[model samples]
Target: MTRPKTTPLPPTIVVVFGITGDLARRKLLPAIFDLYLKGLLPSQFRLVGFMRRDLSKLEFQTLIQDSLTKYHRGASSTSLKKFLKLIVLEQGQFDDPAAYERLGEQLKSLDNSLGVCTNKLFYLAVPPALYPTIFPLIKKSHLAKACESARAGTGWTRFLVEKPFGRDLGTARSLERQLKNIFTEDQIFRIDHYLAKETLQNIITFRLANPLFANIWNRGHIVRVEVRLLEQEGIVGRGSFYDEVGALRDVGQNHLLQMLALVAMETPATLTAASIRAARERVLKGLKLAHSDFKESVQRGQYEGYLNESGVAPYSTTETYFKINATVTTGPLRGVPFTLESGKGLPVKKTEIKIYFKNLKLIPVEVESGEVGNVLTFTIQPNEGVALSLLAKEPGLDYLVTEKNLEFAYATGWPDRLIPSDYERLLFDALMGDSTLFPTRGEIIASWQFITPILNQLNKLPLTRYRRGDLPSVS
Candidate 1:
């Protein structure tokens, strides 16, 4: 495989909204440092952290330095020094219009010093509540206005928004409206970090680039698709947030469904963002679940003793687990059932998609039956790689068929790999003005549409409760 040549990026500034937040400390900052160490970041690039904390620029630098040191042990002090030199801190409340104006001035100064009108990527790492205030502030401060470089067909400005886009369809639409008023569809990126995972992106290339899988990736050969994202630990400190937004919206609606689309979407005409997103949007719109199909097809659950957890309401009915079966109405995989199951406090942590292909049942000779189906599994976590389970006769005698897994483990097979965190890849894409892995507004709304019904019916369905150390009893 040939690597794409690294094109030198124009000078740019990345402004993080929630600089002091856990996400920035643990994921975003480390990703930036990694990019810098790899020489992927432009020499003229700068990082500006915006938060309401009353910390000085030096304090903010120290905080980021501590975070990078703790989270990224592999990063060297030399590279860290170079990266830290790029840091700048600004203090401001999200609702304060004046703060945005100050930020605008700071950006202008940077542009002037760089001798070019630089690009900007605003990453809203803050809470959803702040979105309303921040976006309008950005618009009013003229931050969203096209930069001079943009007019000359050089620079670009983009917004990288983190999800849950909204609680449901109505709110999702409202957020969409808010975004459109400030930024164009092409300029807004709804970041789904799962899409940045190596295996997740590889799904497209695995299908289109390889004729062996592409030819049979259809309903005729595929029986059922299972997407499972199980976690060993429950929502530890996110009880307040998790309780309000249950498993369905938290994980099933976005991460799980995103994987399903990648698995079920047809081959795009071209590999561009527009073509790939259009294909995904088509699949999302084609997802069919009649109102009556909810009971038999959807299953909800909760881990026992959730109410006893700190920050949870007494007698909380919020589901800690969710599983739903859906069918696609278009493309070669139409009518193929997609079963998506996700939950916290499961037996073990694993995120994978299992494509169970039809077995060779028509074979004349009968062998002792086992799990005989040809299963293609894309493991996204714990062990990130692809595996194919084929039926093979057991050695020495009695015709017994067994499953043999031929595996490609990313962590092992690809030794000395420089795989970046999902944030790194996503932030890089946003900086480079690539929206391939980012979800579009249409895709977001369509996903909520597919999920809203199940969420609405969550109360009516029976939610099984199991021990924290065990998988949900619903299965």
Candidate 2:
């Protein structure tokens, strides 16, 4: 199979805030290096790390080098050195205006030196609290204003925000309002990295580009849709944050819901970012909230002995597992049931979406109840691939049938292919000014609108408890 051609980006500089943070060291920097290794970066590109530490450029370089060595030691030193040469470090406090002013001057100096209206993409890899302060500073310093650079379409400025876009509906709206005041809608990229996963993006292609699947992707042919993101390990060290955020906000509201949108949304007229987001918005808006019977429609659970974990409140009721049954009220999938589930400390770590199609025809022989048949699954983890389950007649004279799986795995089917991590693909898109995979404000608001009611009624519902490795029914 031929890979899609990547459009070459113009000369760009990525300014990463909170450079010393764990995400930068583990995911962002390694992804940047991988892009360089794949020769996907622009000819003239640089990385600027903004932090509060008082380390010299060399010391900062050494710090990143150590981290790279620890996580990506297999990287060739020759290429690693080349990638490192493009990095420059600047030390400053996040809330200080002088720091941003100085950083802006530095960026302007680089733009002048390059003789191009250099595109700047600021990655707010910092905590959520810093957003209110950082965005205004970015605008005030003239780093991302809707001036001649962005207006003329010669150069561009974009903000790549980290997830948990807001804690709830009101907070999300407030953040959106603040962002609107600073940057245009087109300039903001609210990232949920799961959307960039190879299989996730391929979902649209699999449905729209394939006649067999597209024709049957409706309520008439499908029974139900299930999206699950399960993990086996409990919150090891992030108890403080996880306790407050819970599994619903940590993964349910964004990742699982986004997957549901992709599964239930109507096909768009085109494949542009706007078109895709519009489709998602329509599906999200069509979601039927489980307000009156949320206790029955929604379920929440905490793992056994969760309160014994460090940093958790003794009487904490935060849910570590969340599952909801939702319905789409419009489009071809109107009336179709959809289940969104996510939890930590489950039996296994897996992320997959299953489309259970109605058995249009009866079997030639008797069959047992509670048996699965005619299902298509997009397995996103463990072994990333697509699999379809079909019934096949046993090779005997008697009329007998059994379940069989036809599977395609990235590791096995495309052994020679190298799939980039989610971060690499998303970072590349941000550099090219592509918002196709990023979450829009409308989508976020719609998601919150659907989830806020459940959150408000949490106090009324009982939080179930199970053992650490036990698997709870999520159907």
Candidate 3:
């Protein structure tokens, strides 16, 4: 008999752990509401928020509406108002036992009302300290257990935890083991939202699909790689937290590192994620851990605390930004230092990775569009998008390179660009029990393998100070 094509289910319910926190307000809710407005949400979908906020259901919707209007980019007012109706709020303590039971009931009612066993997606957006107490609580609450039961007709449940997965290698490993022991590795989905950006995802696809580009994606043709992240604003509310996390963990270890892996990883045997990650993981391990490479390729710093932020401790020694340059330790490109910059305060509101071909100075000039050299930049945030910036020949006959850009943002109706929130996508992946995107125990261990040096240096030594609003890091 021919196997039937099993239909996939749309999202039914999302339970956010820190529903009232900054992440929930700034990114999660806005992205979800945007997903809803776009007609992507299930007809029976609902949002079940977990927080200590003392507010009624209507009040929570009001809170989310305010954020959707104020912070959501490319969102329509009418669409947002309609989305408010689909959201259902639940007030409960994150760590309390009774709270877990209350949450279970809330999910049950919504799932039953939907006429099918609905999905239970947990977004752990609370502080890192709260995860230990909350994660197991989520599991113990019978929600996580339900997901693992695999009984026919039972609803799926998934948990999405935020980063700072752990402070060091040991913690990261232990945490992964713990989570996996409870939920299959396939059941957990990690969200390094940068992966969802079309440009980064497109890096391999665009290169391979086009013979023009794929033919020379090797040492024979390429030169240096530059990863830059700039933030135009100082740490407003997350200074202390960011200070503890630092740039290495803030962006480098996760976003930048992930991007570097995607760009530099050997062409997988195939497009299958396992094939790609197998190649990527090998590249990550090839990084040089020696002190010399450490100094030249890695850097750490804290921006001078602003006067009125109240976030910086009077004697705080935490660093808010960092820059790193290092080469991969294995493969054809070994010894080529990959430079990365991450900072708390800066003049430009951008995060991008620019791959310079041949040399930093001589970029490929675009014959048309009045451009010179080809530069690919993946832009994340302010608006989620990607821009292909190339240097073109000067308008006159001179050989000077001019710059031209072809950008794709979510608002323009790019299909993949309209994917669900990083949280939503990860949660959905988790409920479906897929761990392809989430970092594995080995990957987590590997992340800290190279990352420990920077962390140790931060704890053992004084940080090099940087001016607020300066370029995050440098050569």
Candidate 4:
């Protein structure tokens, strides 16, 4: 595929709400610096770090330098110095009104220095609990509005929100209402970093562009779909947060469902954001648990040492692992079963989608009963690649069948290509006003509608216990 032309970006100011947070240090700041290195950011760009920490300008710069060095290695000293020049720190508490006023003044100063109204991208990198506190303050400070008095409203404002959008449907709806009151639908960019991964995006392109796969992507040709997101690391420092959230809400509702939608949704009419999101939303709306009884379709498990983890309750029923069987009731995927599983502290860290194809019974060649059919896999992480497993005759006189893997890895297949990190691609897309990689409000709501019911019945279902590295029993 030919590379698309890069468009010039407008002069903009990015205001990161929680600059001291882990996400900012690890992903957001690193991504922004990468964009700077690539000259994707405009010459008049500025990154305003909004946090309560009162540090000197030099101190803030040093901290950011350390972060870049740790998270983004091999950055040249010259580039680091140039990037640091764009950093501006705003010391303020989330609930402090005076702090917001000062931030407004700082933004005005930035605009004045540019001699024109600049676009603003506010990144709420903080936790969801602080969203309510910050949302009203932004509106009260008139930060969401364009500068009509100073300039003729040439600038646009966008909000980038991270996910686990909400705990459940009610909370998600409430959050939507809060955001709607403050910002318009188009102004809101709901970040689902998974959607921005090269491999994930390729799923749509691979299906649509390749006639070989597209022709057979349906219930008739496929058997069952499996979307698995497994992690090898435990909740080490995040026990408090993890204990409350568990695996289902943390990934099942967002990542797993999103991947399943991409795998099952019909070919979109066009490749635009509207068409793609509409296709996903339709699949999400039609999804339901395969069994009415939650226990029959859902399995929950807690890691063996979860109780000993810091901030976790001794008798906590929170599930660190979950496996769900869901079915699509509409479209061409009707009656197809999708196994969505996610867990922490597993033996391996992997995120992939496996599509099983029906085996051909008409063939005269003898095949073992244990031999499965062709399996097409989209590996999202650990290694970004796609592989198709097929039964082939073994290299011997006897006609024995063995599974052969035809793999395409991004690293080996495109050695010189610089694949952007999930956060990097997402941040760049947000700046370019491209919402194709982000989730829509309707998609979020539809996902929650399907997941909320299962979550509600989770308490009644007994939680199984398994060791950290062991694969939990599904039955």
TM-score, structure 3 vs. true: 0.81
> What is the RMSD, in Å, between candidate 3 and the native fold over all Cα?
5.0
Model 4, span 1-475: residue lDDT tens: 2225466766899999999888999999999998888888877899999998888998888989999999995788899998998888999899999999999999999999999789899999999988989999999999999655425434889899989788899999999999999998888999888898888899987887899888888889888999999999998799899888988989899999899888888888888888888999999999998887778899999889889999998899999999999999876678999999999989999999998888877564455646478889999999999999878889989867778899999999999987898888888888777788888899999999999988888988888899889999868
Decoy 2 TM-score against native:
0.96
Worst 10 residues of 4 by lDDT: 146-155
Clashes of each: 0, 0, 20, 0
lDDT of 2 at 152: 65
Tell me how candidate 2 scores on lDDT: 0.86
Which has the better lDDT: candidate 3, or candidate 4? 4
**lDDT winner between candidates 2 and 4:** 4
List CA RMSD, all candidates. 1.8, 2.0, 5.0, 2.0
Model 3 / residue 50 / CA error / Å: 2.2
lDDT of each: 0.86, 0.86, 0.68, 0.88
Residue 246 of model 1 has an lDDT of 84
Give the TM-score of each candidate. 0.96, 0.96, 0.81, 0.96
Q: Which residue runs of candidate 4 sit more than 4 Å off their true CA positions?
A: 1-3, 147-154, 364-369
Candidate 1 lDDT, tens digit per residue, 1-475?
Answer: 1236466888889999999999999999998888888789887999988899999778887888889999984878787887888988888989999999889898898889899888888889998877888888899998987676686656788889999899899999999999999898878989899999999999988887889888899898998899999999889999898889888888988999899899989888888898999889989999976235568888888888899888889999999988787889877798899888999989999999999888767663443544557888999998899999877778976776666789898888888886779999988887777789999899999999988977887899887988988877674
lDDT: worst 10-residue window of model 1: 363-372
